[model samples]
Target: MTVRNLPPVSELTEQQQRGWSCVWCAAPLSTGTAINLGEQRHEPAFGSPYWWFPRACPDARACAKREVTGDRR
Candidate 1:
């Protein structure tokens, strides 16, 4: 599925990168309840490339709402 471009990895929290929270809203998400956005690869300037998993709530609208309003849940 298509999704908006993710925020820069440097700006994301550990939970967001680990798929434990919504990437956009920063809301906690139960396993199997979030939509996997797929693994992302990052090539740092001084280290080997690494991958980070990103997930989001099933309801994109709600996620966006929470993001815009700063309502993390």
Candidate 2:
């Protein structure tokens, strides 16, 4: 699976961080239909590394379409 570069955690919503929504388009996702982006580790300058599980829509093209069309806020 191609692991695309993820957006910064700080820019993501809590739902995105928890893998409940598409990381790119912020669409709702079900486990069976979502593509797991894998575990992400964020190392801060002053603290321990934080781990996050990210997922995206199965159809990346659609997600990108939504993003480009401004369907997602």
Best candidate according to TM-score: 1
What is the clash count for each candidate, in the order shown?
A: 0, 0
Local distance difference test, each candidate:
0.91, 0.88
Worst 10 residues of 2 by lDDT: 64-73
Judge candidate 2 at residue 38 and give its lDDT.
86
**Cα RMSDs, all models:** 1.2, 1.9
Cα displacement (angstroms), candidate 2, residue 62, comes to 0.8
Best by lDDT: 1
Residue 16's lDDT in candidate 2: 95
Residue range 1-73, candidate 2, lDDT tens digits: 4667899988999999999998989989988999998899988778788898899999888889987786873
* lDDT (Cα, tens digit) per residue for candidate 1, span 10-34: 8999999999999889999989789
